[model samples]
Target: MDLHLKGKNAVILGGTRGIGRAIAETLAGEGANVAVCARNAGQVAETVEALQSRGVKSTGASVDITDADALKSWIRKAGVELGGIDILVSNAGAMAQGNTPEAWTQNFQLDVLGAVNAFNAAEPFLDKAAKSHGDAAFVIIASVSAAQADRADSYGPVKASLIHFAKGLARENAAKRLRVNVVSPGMVYFEGGIWHMIETNQPEFFKQANSRNPTGRCATPQEIANAAVFLASPASSYTTGVNLIVDGAVSNRVNF
Candidate 1:
């Protein structure tokens, strides 16, 4: 499928590894120039090199998303270097799972405010792209846990906030031709990802979680990335203000 992403410029937060890396690679594969940022300098460099090797203009910075000033600066610099930002993927998250105050603060700072700051910093560039190209997109990588409550966890509520914020942003930006959407992935398993840790340390729990899925497995990072990149591409021009779940039917609640 031609995503019509050639020549487009995209910025992805937390793009060094796991799901974020998958999204960055997918976008670059579709010919979008990409700028990525993460806290690990080595991983950032490696991911940037990988993207560039795919024949797309790619740049990356090592910056903590929780540092709002640094994050905004990186976004602006990326726009300048990449020429402009047509797509912004807010994929960073603290993944804080507890109900502790510290966990709540961490999730809020990284997951919620991170997206807020990135969008604010990228808005002007996105507006410009929309004006020139007739379309621009912001894709937030949320989690299916947002709509499910197996326990009291900070992560789920923080993710839910993101979905609410995305819908509101989508409506507000519609007139400007800038689309906003959320991709809520469920139990995406990768070597170094959260599910992998569960699979290793809590084998029985991981097995149960895997069995909960009718597919008898969790999603792959690339599967989630495919949905994210598609939502950010012009191919999904009419798709906005929607929470697209890529959960392999692990989630039983009807979206409606």
Candidate 2:
């Protein structure tokens, strides 16, 4: 199905790797100009090059999402470089896991503040696209853990906040014709960086998660990218303020 996304411009926070990178690739493949930002300057440059090779005008920047001012400036810069911003994918967060209180605090700072900062910075650009341009949307990448709270530092609450924030923003901006939505992903594995910890340190727990999932395994970054594309594309023009869950039924299964 044609997503009707050609020529549109997007800013994907933390799009240097993992799911964010996947989303960037998917969007660029759909013919959208994409700009991604992450702290790793090298990875950011590599991703931009890879996207451009796909024939989409793309750029990359090294910015920390947790810093509000820096995030806002980057968003503005992306809009300028991409020509305009039609989609904002807030996907630059990490699992805050540590056995200490400081670890938990850092988790909230990154998870919650990161999402909030991205949204706040992108709001102006999103509104501009809807009013000045034609159709535009905001797709936020959250996690199924938001619904399950079984993750670190009650990380569930942090993601849950993003889900709710999308809802509220959808409502607030609907009159302006700007759409906001959330995509919740279940257990996903890719490069094996984060997964190494689970598979190596908590093999039993990892086994249970795979068995619980209906597919008997985890989803891929590409799978989650498909959902992000849907939300950000014209295909979902009328859909907004909705939490689209793509968890392979892991969140729905009965846990005993």
Candidate 3:
């Protein structure tokens, strides 16, 4: 499937590991230059090197997404280095699950505001790309938790806010040929990921979660990445303002 993404440039948040890393690799494999950022300097360097191995121009920075000033600066610098930003993938999240004020604040700052700031900083670059290439995209990595209420947690609500925000951005940017969409993954499992920790430390709970999926397993990072990269590609040019769920049927609620 030629995504028609060759020569396109992408900026991905938290792209050093797990789902973010998968997305970055998939985009680079599809021939897009990628710029990534995460707090782990070693991981960031490794990911950038791996992406570059795929024969695409790749760059990375170690920065906290919660730091708006630093994040915006990285985004702008990435745009300058990559020539321009045709795609922006906000894949970082705090994963703060409690109802405490601290949890709420953490989720809001890293998950919600991170996307907000990244998009705001990348807007001019995206606009320029759209004007030149006739298409640009912003794909937010939300979660299926946004639509499910398993407990009283800040994670779900904060993710829900991202969907709402992306919808508005999609509507407002449609005229500019900039698409905005969300990929809501459910129980994606990967080594060193949250689900992996659950599988290791909480065996029974991990089994229960796996059983909840009709597929008898959680999604792999690659599966979720496939959806995200596709949405960010020109092949999905008509798809915008939509939350694409990759939950292996674990979610029962109909989106409509």
Candidate 4:
């Protein structure tokens, strides 16, 4: 598919590795200039280089997505550097699971507020892009856990909040041609990712978890990235205020 993404500019938060890295590479492959930000400077640099190698402009910065001010600055700088921000992907999460207050704070600040801040900081550029190109997008990388919870933890609830937030943004920004959507992935596995660590440290438990999925395995980062990029592309201009689940039948809960 063409995706009509040529020359478009995108910025992704936490785009150095895993799903985020896949999204960046996929966008660049489709001829979109991409800017990425993450806390690890080395990873950010490497990702940017890889994206650029695909023949699209790419740049990155070491940034703490939890710090509102620093995140805003990097995004705006990236927006200018990339010429404009047509797509903003909030792919960062604290990934701190548990019933502790610290976990709640981490998830709330990074997962929820990270998306909020990125949208706010990039709104002007997105609006400008929409005005010129007739469409713009903000895609949030949520998780299928938002719809199911096995225990009381901050991860699922925090992810659920993102779906709510994106829906509201879609409605409010419709007139401006700024599309907002969410992609919920389940059990995505990549090297150095949460699932990979578990797979290495606890083989039996990992096998049990993977067996629960109808596919008898987990999703790859590229699989999640594909859906995310599609949502962000102008090809899906009519898609908004929707949460697309890419869980590969792993989640049995009937989406109501």
For each candidate in the order shown, give its overall lDDT on alpha carbons: 0.95, 0.84, 0.95, 0.95
* TM-scores of the models, in the order given: 0.99, 0.92, 0.99, 0.99
Q: Total clashing residue pairs per candidate?
A: 0, 0, 0, 0
Clashes of 3: 0
lDDT of 4: 0.95
Model 2: per-residue Cα lDDT over 51-149, one tens digit each: 999999999889987788998888888898988889988887767665467766666777677777877777778888888765689888888877775
TM-score of 3: 0.99
RMSD of each: 0.7, 2.6, 0.7, 0.7
Q: What is the C-alpha lDDT profile of model 4 across 4-46, one tens digit per residue?
A: 9999999999999999999999999999999999999999889
Worst 10 residues of 1 by lDDT: 247-256
Scored against the true structure, residue 153 in model 4 reaches a CA lDDT of 93
Per-residue lDDT tens digits for candidate 3, residues 55-103, read: 9999999999999999999999999999999999999999887999999
Model 1 bad stretches (over 4 Å): none
Consecutive 10-residue window with the lowest summed lDDT within model 4: 247-256
TM-score of 4: 0.99
